[model samples]
Target: MKKLIMSKTLIFLFVFSFINVFIKFFGGSNTLIGVTVVTAMLMFLERDLTIEPIKNTFKLLGINVFLGVLSFLAVQNIGLGVVANFTALFVVGYLFTYDLKRPMYIAFGLQYLFMVGSPVSANEFPVRLLSLAFGALCIMIPQFLVNKNKLEKSSKKIFISTSEDILTKIRNIKENKNIEEINLKIENNINSLKKMLYDNRKDEFYLNDSAIDILNMGLSLERISLILDNYYDKKMNNNASDLNNKNQEICLDIMESEIKKLKLYIEKEELIEYDINLDEIEDINLCEFYIVLNNIHDYFDEYKKRKNTKSEKLYTGNLQIPSNFKISNIHMRGLSKESIRFSYAIKVALAGAISGFIMDYFNLSEGRWIMFTIFSVIQPYSENCIIKSKKRIQGTLVGGTMIFILFSIIKDPSARGIIIVLAGYLGSYTTDYRDSMIFNTMSAIGSAAMIGSVSILFINRILFVLLGIAIGLVVNKFILPYDIKKGYKYLVDMYERVNLEMIEEINLCIKSKHNNYKMKNLLLVPGLIEDRMSLMGINDKEQKHFIKEQKHLTSSIYNLYVNIATNKIKDNDFNEMLKESNCISECEEVKDVIIDSIKNTEDIGTKVACKNLLQILNSLNNKEQKITV
Candidate 1:
């Protein structure tokens, strides 16, 4: 409840209302309108009200708004309106189309362009932009007054929490417990940590390097746990011998001790040396128990080195704006299917055009309401459209009823003003609460009712909202509807980019002379692949296989980092293997060969796994061969 009141959204509403009321008192409607223009423009520019400034906010706003006004003027040409609007949508779509990057400002511009029945008068554009720039400054003022270092501090806590969770899981494994629940918890923490890393980077905080190290460490720990789990399962087999039991106990003891040392090292922020003796452990080859132990040892050794290393200052630079914005990244997606942005742009433009035509033909008053409704309610997915449709209806009903009742009793100007203020507060406070749209709508209509003709406005608003929703539904269903395949393909395209970036970061970090070279592209390939697979469902065998290979590749990348950290890659044999390449079918083949070699007490299994790991590294670095796909 307390957090709700302090939330930036609520604060923004308060500031807007306070400024609007103040301006209304001094300069009346002209000033109030100017303030509204500024507030609305700035609010749209700010997608999430984080302290970080938008990338090229001023530049993007200038270009988009200028183009929007031009487009709006073209739309006033009776015969050319639909064609102009359609052309504007495609142009905006193409201009902003970067692979995996959504340009929300383009959408914002379209909304502004179609805001009224005609283009805002030529003279009003400059005044409105000046007001908007002032509003943007006002919004940023509070950001400076308050300390936003909480993001940095909280992110560090999240990173620490992730490490603690992993340690708990390892300790639980020692008690012979079911680790599935703990595994889920660790996964959740890791995801939260990833979000923090991105958030910190977005804020341009100095803790980015530390966050990356923590994330990498957490992933390495997870890989180590998997190794332990596999070894534990093999040792606990029904055909297990006394030799397996002895070896299992020794490995468990070694792991438990090393994990304790790791926890100590993390907590104290100091180095801790540890060693495991495979020569001392009897029958090390009986179950390949030594291999898992060796990996864990390498991980711990690497963790210590990475933790002690003081990283160089990360690159903190201003965002760049391209001189030309016409390039389309859709072709880079390497898909025959049209990009979703292109498809969605067409859907929105077509639906909006049809709505405008219907309104113009009927000679409806305030036809701008129809365009606003279509812009607000139409969505990328059918399910989203349905949900938004329900919300719109509920909001309209609440707003209309509130206005009707308020206008009947409130005749005194001063009394109505008080009511408006109170209603605004209630609406703003509950905007994020249950029936948020309803409260927001109620506030808007109720405020208008206090000063203007309520009955007509109420009826028009509700009618247009319903009409827009209906048109949006028809267009989405009959036009290019939601295509999960296309969405999956797009996600895969994004994953490929992320994968390449992650590998490149690792490559740079390894080669850099700087002791503290932070990895810039920390892509969560596993999570991304999971999302893609979920969209494709169980029927996509090729995507499934690709996801599996990618997971192995990601794990191998981390494990190779661990190997490099431990100086294991310095070994002549390992160095030679890292330089070689093999066309491996899958990680499973390598795993199978490893298991067979272990059963036969041969080095082939270990060699196969090492070769496969190197192959993934090579594939990622050399995009010419591109994962043999």
Candidate 2:
């Protein structure tokens, strides 16, 4: 249950807060307050966006200038301002197609632009742009210091830790020491493995072979834990607290011993040599037992193949990827209604346009805050928007109340300044939406009070933010409305497509007798979709089935890759069988060829790979799980 916010928030507390304090000491105003807040957010976004320094440089300069100009133009004409908001929001939504992190930094830059963009003379335009350039510079510090490599390394480290944690759990099961609680912890660690993997994926659009190894390794760990769960449940009576069967106790003991050895092997530590044969275990269900045994040998198999393995990259297009692009991440797509980015852009742009028009026509106090609120709460899905809006409102309420109480007690400007600084730091350090808003409310009210009359700023902010939330929710529901239901089918289709592509690649690798598993970057597709579906606050049978199928499908594909590609089991015989079966339109013919070869072959690698291919084909549409000896 590690909160992702901890490390990131600590970095924000030290790096960006220092710069904010420096600005405050040198005549900071309301505009600077907005700038500092946006800069803090930008620092977080920057960490997710770029992997290299030069790419960041171009992005920082180009994005700041674009947002700065839009903001300045937004000030001159009301109609143009409405257009500016729409265009900016559209770009944010559309950029989601390119990089997952694009919308974040762009949206933060918009806020900075708006803060220094308005109610000023023409002569102030250059100065405003200059300040934004400085904001980008502030963000660059954290981005360059803590980039994707740090997290990628962190992900690898998690692999070792997950194994150790599972090792502890297995030992607990052996001792029967609060086995239920240990099971819970094991489940939590499995999820942690998933989160850590995707956290790295979300940061980069590129992935190397090592990243792919992490995903496959995680899949193996997940299967190991699940198989253990099933075996222990059947073996140990949880409800009756019944004694372990004396008949099976020895087999379980052997499992525990072997798992410990497996952990040591993954850590590259010396293993205790065993005189006994693993396959000789007298177990009722040798299926799970053999799967675990095979999994233990998997790391070594992959390692042997990886030595001469030419790492492949993602992207099948003619356009050369700018970076080395070594990592696997989400793939790009075309414009369509089903596209998350396309529909999201249209929805956000419409909301931004409406918010901007209201701000201009009514000239409501801090009306721009309404647009900001709309931007913050509105998501690709309206259901998510409602949930986010609720949290945002709760945050604003508590934050406003805190500010009123604290400011009421301390009337001295110097004393309040210290309090305000503390509040801002907490806000910057917060990763939760509700908590951040609570502290952000105090800091916002206190900072505004310093520049203007403190009379009604707190109440005005509370009301305005609420109004914005209400408006955003309504607009999201009525305009280009999308929910998890709409996206679920699309994601399922995408999942199927990616799986099919993997099967195709496996076929090609067998034929060529060379491996080219280049779909690593796009491996994030299933995980990302599953995550979003979970966030929808859904628990229906249909959604649950979808989630289950996704898990099954992805794990099957990874298993297939491990069996066929990672082991490097293919030889001239595999190519010849593949060529002989090429005339058949169906993979069933290929599966038949493989199954026949498996019965005739004594090579362990070839037999295991052929069996796995048969299983994979069986899962797809065939039921040929066995072959006569």
Task: Give the poorly placed runs of model 1, Cα more than 4 Å off.
Answer: 5-14, 17-55, 71-119, 134-155, 171-185, 192-215, 221-268, 272-337, 357-363, 412-434, 484-522, 525-553, 561-567, 570-629
Q: Report the lDDT tens digits of candidate 1 across residue range 220-308.
A: 55555555555545544668688866666666666667666656765665666655554344443222333433444454445446446
Tens digit per residue, CA lDDT, model 2, 147-237: 6455445555665676677677667666765555554454455555454444444224444445455566666776566445545655466
Error of model 1, residue 81, in angstroms: 4.7
User: For each predicted model, how many residue pairs clash, with residues at least 3 apart or on different chains?
Assistant: 2, 9
Candidate 2 TM-score, C-alpha based: 0.75
Please state the error at residue 19 of candidate 1 in Å: 4.7
**In candidate 2, residue 613 scores what lDDT?**
57
